[model samples]
Structures are given as structure tokens and as C-alpha cells.
Target: MAALILILLLALILGGAGFAVHILWWIAVIVAVLWLLGFVFRSAGTGGTRGRWYRW
Candidate 1:
């Protein structure tokens, strides 16, 4: 009985995941495309402060 319940629970979770996979894949693709575009169009302003000590 316990094993049967566990199997049913696992099946439900897996079925839910499978049902949303189509939408999830599209969301992932859109995010990846946006990230690539941002990298391509990023600016190069403001140089980072290097490790330097100035004595007053």
C-alpha cells in the first residue's frame, strides 16, 4: 500500500512537470535570447577601481 501511494504521487508530479515543459522551454529560450542580446549591446563605461593605495 505504501509503495502504491508513493508511485501514484511520483506519477502526479512527473505528469505536472511534463505538462508544463512546453511553456517552460519557451520561457527558457526567451530568457537566453534576451541575455545574449544584452551581452551584445552592453556598454563599456566606468572602469573598475584597481587595487591601489594612495598615501595622503
Candidate 2:
């Protein structure tokens, strides 16, 4: 009985980790797209000079 419970717990933990990783992948893709858009649409800075959208 204890072994069965342990197996179930392990399976549950692995499943949860998989779900979290999938969500993280989606978030990464979204951030990448936003970064690309920022690069494409960067604003002009002082004295008509083109500058980066991000400070860094």
C-alpha cells in the first residue's frame, strides 16, 4: 500500500512539472515575440538619432 502511494505521488509530481514546463515554453515564445517587435519598432532618440527601445 505504501509503495502504491509513493508511485502515485511520483507520477503526480512529474505530471505537474511537465505542465509547468509547457507553460514556461509558451511564456518564452511570447517574450521573444515582444522583443522582436521592440527591435523592429525602436524609437528615435536625441538629435534625430536612432536609439534602442530598451535601456540596456
Candidate 3:
């Protein structure tokens, strides 16, 4: 009986870990998309100036 309980507990722990990993994967994808969008907007908005607007 004790061994059965331990086995069940271990399975639950592993299942929870897998769920957490799935959530993290989605979060990472979202962050990557946002970063790409930011890069595009930043470069275009700068208009080739990059470092400064009109050099004072």
C-alpha cells in the first residue's frame, strides 16, 4: 500500500512538471514575437538615423 501511494505521488509530480513546461513554452513564444515586433518598429521609426536624430 505504501509503495502504491509513493508511485502515485511521483506520477503526479511528473505530470505537474510537464504542465509547467508547456506553459513556459507558450510564454517564450509570445515573448519572442513581441521582441521581433519591437525590433521592426524601432528600426523603421528611427528612419536610418539610429544613433541620433539630426546630430543636434
lDDT of each: 0.77, 0.97, 0.78
TM-scores, in order shown?
0.49, 0.87, 0.75
The runs of at least 3 residues in candidate 2 whose Cα sits more than 4 Å from the true structure, single-residue gaps closed, are none
lDDT per residue as tens, model 1, 1-56 = 99999999999999999979988999999999987876666555457633223223
Q: What value of lDDT does candidate 3 attain over all alpha carbons?
A: 0.78
| Candidate 3 structure quality by residue, lDDT tens digits, 1-56 | 99999999999999999999999999999999987776566542355574422334
Q: List the residue pairs that clash in candidate 1.
A: none
Q: Please give the RMSD of candidate 3 to the true structure.
A: 5.6
Look at candidate 1 and tell me the lDDT of residue 51: 27
As a whole number from 0 to 100, the lDDT of residue 1 in candidate 2 is 100
Which 10 consecutive positions of candidate 2 have the poorest summed lDDT?
47-56
Error of 1 at 42 (Å): 0.6
- Writing each residue's lDDT as its tens digit, candidate 2 over 1-56 gives 99999999999999999999999999999999999999889999999998989977
Residue 51 C-alpha lDDT in model 2: 93
